[model samples]
Target chain A: MSKSVRKKPAAPKKPVAPRKPAAGKKPVAAKKAAAVKAAGMAKQPDIAPLLTVSDIHTYYGDSHVLQGVSLDVKPGECVALLGRNGAGKTTTLRSIVSLTPVRRGHVGFDGLDITHSPTHRIIREGIGYVPEDRGIFSSLSVREHLDIALWAAKKPPERRDEVLKIFPRISERLEHFGQQLSGGEQQMLSIARALLAEPRLLILDEPSEGLAPIIVDEVRDTLARVKKTGTSILLVEQNVAMALALADRVVVLSQGMVQFTGTPAELEAQPDVKDTYLGIA
Target chain B: MTFFLFNLLNGLQLSMLIFLMAIGLTVIFGLMDILNLAHGAFYMAGAYFGYVVFQATGSFWIALAIAPLLPLVLGFLLQYFVLQPLIDRGRSAHLDMALLTFGLLFFTIGLIDLVFFETLGLTFMSIDKPAGLGSYVNIGTFYPSYRLFIIAVGLLVALIVWLLLERTVVGAVVRAGVDDREMVRAMGVNVYVVFASVFALGCGLAGLAGVIAGAELSINITMGVQILIPTLVVVVLGGLGSVKGCFFGSLIVGMTETLSQAYVPALALFATYLILAAMLVFRPQGFFGRTPKSV
Candidate 1:
């Protein structure tokens, strides 16, 4: 009970104070993390990853998937996880959310060991998830979805307007149910729903999947706007170009293992890793 | 026409009673995806609990008030402690839990029979209709006041529930949980708590329905078993997870069953199934259910 009530629902969606390093960890790791993050994002505090997933092994039935996956997202930085079909990209996001429990490894978030935490508790720690499918309830109206998101986040109702401004298209369809929305509209609602929670870390599985090129560009621009608000994002995408364009750091995965971690420019320089793993030259 | 009115009122009474039972079942299944076969047991236990309360207090009102608590708490404990653990351990074993509840259904039947029939040497019991409600009242012609009360209460509950689910933020949370349990949890809502609360509410309604129905029919060990299939039919006819569907489903099944028993005695037993069959053949999702979820 104390697990949730201890933290007030995050303040209205603004760039709150930069996250401090989690307590009781070696200051060396925090300093090293800060040094690595300093190269990209200047605004982040000298802290360990706002989100740290270390050596997680997840399995789907007997199939050995996500063999020792690890990654980090610094405060306000967007990390793109690049992988092919069946590369366990979505599973990694699900693992962090604890939707898919990791068999072995640590998922530390905001200073808490959350690998075993229930999905809701992990989310309550200020990580909002936009699942791969855009997870819209066909029977519920657009307003209800937004209301539910606000309620879950424990945010005031006034934030609805502020959140809706991110995706103006959804505002007009407030009365429309989930099934009534077009795919782009659904994607917008999905992001808007997560944003309503005012998370410190936002995990989107595939914001661009099944979307047209124009809509993908629209999504990228909207995400860029969200990035300005200082929310760390972990994006899993098959759209290499979108991922490369938005990411500060890219982690390439192949056959459930981390194959490379570098800047987009570094990844582009090494065509072997990019072409062999991501099918890009 | 007077005779038709009498049957219509009777059908409504049954429909209203079953509506209470069906809504509980539908909502529980809708949110948790748990087809609780023991819902009928909760209905029977409610009557037995009400019988105890009514016997001691000699007040129907008191019995109605207290009886639902037994099943409500029991349902919460069952979902939170037993069923949830099983579900967590074996996500693939949902049907096994259904069968386990099937066992629980009969276990409750035997237990009810033991306490009420075997040990107490009772064959059947019925609650007395409250004063002023026993006598007939003028509707179109003279109608049993209690039956009319049941219909009124049922309609009132339906309206209240519809408003609660459609208009409130709490209901939105629940409906969202129903639509996408994973996403709801991902949003930081404690879905297990929601599941337990819904399960408790459903069982509580069953208990309330039991006490209401007790006045109309004798409570026997087999009473819960008897209503199980009809209510299941109501749930399916309405849709798997739809409250609106439950309303229309209960009405349609109640009317046909009551009218058939009066007008064509031989078809009474199969009347509910006939509607279920038609709904299955034409719209497998029932009246308002989503495309019947394969998951």
Candidate 2:
């Protein structure tokens, strides 16, 4: 009993501090609202920003994973959260979904303060989580996986049709168990399962991890098609080239702090930013 | 030949009784990951309550109905009030829960032992053999009507449980939960509610089994131990989480125990354990159940 309780101290500390505000200015909720209003400014863009995670500090125990991370995506925008390994990229996505239990700053989704809401409540509020590990129910089949996800998400029937269209790989193997799928196929199923939820905000953590190069390209294409339908996506990927080509905006973190945030063009011109943080010359 | 037929019928009834105990145990262990040793105590409580209610009202029917329902409510309260707090604290280990339940088991059984020492062996005082069907019926051999009723009731209950689990939306959620409870919670079905409901259902079934078994075998405080070991063996043999597996495992254990008792009385003492050992060697996870899993 003491052991389980003792192991959780580091996990709880990160979530509570993040539940407040980072660096003590305004609460994260206020900053998130301000970010969304700033996003709504016509001079910036016309697309409605569905989620804004701004100036957030997140930690896993004493390890500061996401430092001062800020990113936003419009209702139909696809923003890639890109960085090298240990760049706090996945932690940024986790903070936005309230999975990692953020320490500082706030996340606003669809203009609601969801920084402290439970993960289930957040998902119900139209945010879907696809973890880096795929988190598939191995015992259940493809059809059963979708069935549970859809049951939980309570999406309209049309969304299932759209999901099947997005990932035809799963349509052919609905009865196959999740564990039976190959790496690429499992990745596809993970994305497909999340898509069936019809979330307004889809936060995917390292979707391309552990996949063959060809399969990675197929996943990228699938994400692109999904973006075309006006679903806002926050994609965390180490594959920088694909992200640069796909994202409307890019946010990079170095040592748990935001080093750069800009469009693909601005990021391309900053060689020092790339070399110092990404180890890319 | 007559002796063989008689033992076969008795074995079938015993298997059914044990299946009721196991189905609940397996589901609770598989999905909630909680080790419950006091489940037999709950079964005993049902028999005690049934015994009292039958004596007071002299209505076997009311006692049977109230017996299971009382235990179901007790289980729900225990899970909600007691287990939930421990689970919230992350201190609800299998060893801890088993120890806690052991205390409860001893308390409940002791209370019953004190209350009705003489009436402990009473069996189905309210239910009588149907007048026309009381005599033995020959189907290549003769068997009592009451014994056949027990078999028929067990099969019907098993079928209902299977249909409900396989062909319902709730069943889909439950199946998913057994594999990945944390994910199920993240997916937004108040997991506590599901857990409590399943716990109650499992306990309710146990109590119902007690009521049914009371109709077949004599009820006593001693019945708990007699049923528990074999029931657990059946669950392990069937597969930890498979309802269908439990059904088949019960049959195997039942037949083996019955035959061993009749044909080889000397081996009867170790018969159930022998079958369990053989099954463990061949299929450690049980006949229809999957391998011991970590969700």
Candidate 3:
């Protein structure tokens, strides 16, 4: 089944094969770390994961999705979760925010175990999510979107100018409703709304979807600026090149499980992982 | 011309009353997606409660101020404690909830029949206009001051609702919630609180409309079911979940009913149904509702 390789939107800069695990899984090491933290409860070392999801099993009714999936994001590191549609990338993100209830396993955020908390409560603990649909409120104006995000978060509009500066075009369209904006502008508004919450971890689900090439570059640039500010990003993208370009580490999903975890060069190296899991030929 | 002006005022007065009832119905349907058949019960309860308050205090103003609170508290408890949990727990589908409200409607009428008629030995009752609004004002013809006051209250409420939905931060949250409930929650807003607030506010308005209507017309045991038809017609004609649609829909229905009944007494509601049918045929989404997407 030689299908066409899904081309990269961003130039494939450091393409590599997948890193094979000749090594043990992370549970034993994670257990050791958890035990140490519980014993000493010392201040986190620089390497302590900011968002740690360990062996999470989620289901939609009887249909099992996200089977025993686990991953982590360290401080200021961008981890891209890549997969084909139905690979449960979105569910993984939803699980992190507790939007989709996890049937099994643990999700540690910063230090607290937040696996069973409500979506709103999980979000209030500092997670910003921009969903796949862009999640724009068609009746609300751009300014209203920004204001409502802050209002919901119960935070002052302190990041308004600073975040809006990254999205200059959105600043100009403050009065326009979500339906009136073009696709690129809507995506820009979506990202800007998330950034205004002053989240330490910003999770975006395919912000590049449905945008023109030039607009994708614009988004990429804005995201690059956001990443430079030391905000960790957990991005899910069908746009493999775009995800790889920004990601310090990549997790590839195939049939609700992690197929590979490596640097972009490592993902580009293993053509078989890209071919089998990512549907790249 | 005087006769025509008379129908016009009557139409306008009816429109304002329907608007008051329809606004509450629209937001609750829009926010909660609960097709609450019991909404008209709130209007009926409002009139009864207003009558009780008026009897106790001998002040129309006091009745107007206090009557809506009972329905408000009742609606809040119904939604916050009962309806929402059923939906959230996945125990009741929307159809189930709608059926539950239909059951609630019957239950309320039974209680109203028992308390207001059988027990209290009340006949078809009406509240007198307050001293301030007792006299008629000359507007083309002699229009009753109280009717004019209903129109004023209706417009004032419309303005206030518009401001709350469009200008305030809470309104923005509501508008956003209407579009995407889950997204609003993901943004860290507890939408249940918002839903419960809108439910309380909507029921309160219905109660207020009932009290106002009681002053103008006779309030009877069957008033709840009688008003339910017009209110439902207005809600459907305007489109579910839109305040603007409710206002305009109310005007259209109110005017059509009053004018047609006055002139074409034989037609009854043939003309109003014609317009509603035409609306259903040409633009099924109503004035402000989005066109339903095909499955």
Candidate 4:
């Protein structure tokens, strides 16, 4: 693999030649592998992507954060977006949801062009987003949070019970205000709220960003269970190990561009790419 | 002792009027982050609408029923046409909204004066109290039935507003938007719709306050300007977005104004300012406002 050469050399020319072939060869092989995997995924059905973010360029004010990021999430698949700080990982998620509008490129969700759609319309179109800060309403109770999500999504009352089952801790804190809940509990509530929306695709921005090891494991386990239920996920994560554990495919972003896209095993094999881009040795 | 009780009752009546005026202003400010100076214009419009409607129908009840709607429709039109376009332009647009509303306030005042004083040759008009509320009620000492009615209306409106904010999904979205607007929008709420509806509701309530207050006080061109400052004081003392805070703040300012007028007539105007200044020194976010988180 030309992984080592591609990792180094900020100079464009040296990496381009070796990078193109490796990047080109891997995806063709992965797609064939994915198709084979899709055939096995017949029981799950709808192996086609629930979301496709193609060549998106997003900006924050004057700063061009995401230059041209592209990735997709197949139905029931958990795709991990790995990146260093300032690598535009969060921007990618925001752009897809149109929280931060994409300056250019297409965001296709459930067979609709949502590139220019309002944030609410995209959410109504069934892409639930859990922000980096958790976006909790400080004054509202946990139950209120769940109720609002249900109301916004126009989901059934029964969905609240279903979501509560995934994070039983949230049920315990139903009466507690958002500000009163601990960080782990807040994360659980945030995830639970998003789940209650019955979204076709869930875009989580660093769900494991600031959590205890035990809590992270619990979230990972909950997400694994969620995957079993056939909801596609586009997750941005800094915890490389936890991400690798959950992701069916890993898309590594470096300075707002897709540097690598393949399976967890493929990523693990490319240690040089991980070390250079992910700061993981 | 009787004089003291009378002033206290008067203060309570004033407080209710202030509550009616301030609630809408605070909500509009909180949800949209727009300071609408022309909110007073809606109050003025409501009074004028009441006058015209009463003249046409010869019924105070009919005037009360129809007057608030005029401002409500005007508010919706103003939001849809004038303010909504500027909302997305950022903080600079807020300044623009304030200036635009100030201009609207003057424009509306001029319009009212022209229609009533020049066209109709009616100035310094007063709406007669409804037949049911015309007499005095001996509550502790002799309170006007109409004053008592205004207080009842105020409490009822407060309860309704509280229910809307605390119990409904729309309230939840509005409250959440006050905390984090982008998050509310990302949750798939058409925040623009929420903004428009809330702005209209606030204006409608202001109009209701105007019609009710116009019956008690003389309806004139300067009535809106006279009450606008005190209403702003009520909003500031209460908190930017908290309805519960606005209620209590209005009571405090209202009591302060009337009580000071009774005890130290010279300080009535200055006392509210003194209290506000003191509050600012101690609690800048207002009585119920949360301390802003340093980002």
lDDT of 2 at B244: 91
| Evaluation by lDDT, superior candidate among 2 and 4 | 4
Across A1-281, the per-residue lDDT of candidate 2 in tens digits comes to 00011111111111101111224333235453333223222324433357777778887768877766666777666677766788788777767766678777878876677787766788887777777878677777888778777877777666777789878888999989877888888888878888787777677888888889899899899888887776778888888888877776666677776566656665677777677766776
lDDT of 1 at A61: 84
lDDT of each: 0.83, 0.73, 0.82, 0.81
lDDT of 3 by residue, A30-87 (tens): 5323221221112123256778878789999999998878777777778899999999
Give the clash count for each candidate.
0, 8, 10, 1
Candidate 1 per-residue C-alpha lDDT over A89-197 given as tens digits, one digit per residue, 9 for 90 to 100: 9999999998988998878887677889899888877888999989888878999998888877889999999988888899999999898998899999989998887
Considering only N, C-alpha and C atoms within 3 Å, which residue pairs clash in candidate 1?
none
RMSD of 1: 6.4
For model 3, how does the per-residue alpha-carbon lDDT over B1-295 read when each residue is reduced to its tens digit? 9999988988998899988888888878777788777888898889999999998999999999999999999999888999988987775566898799888988988888898788888879998899979998888799789988998999999899988988898888877776777888888887778888899899999999999999999988677777777777787788867778888999998998899899998876587788878988988878887632100
Query: Is candidate 2 or 3 superior in DockQ?
Result: 3
Highest TM-score: give the candidate number: 1
The most accurate candidate by DockQ is: 1
What digit string (tens of lDDT, one per residue) describes model 2 on residues B140-180? 68887777877887898788878767766567667777776
Of the two candidates 2 and 4, the one with more favorable DockQ, higher being better, is 4
lDDT-wise, the better of 3 and 4 is 3
- For each candidate, give its TM-score against the true structure: 0.92, 0.81, 0.89, 0.90
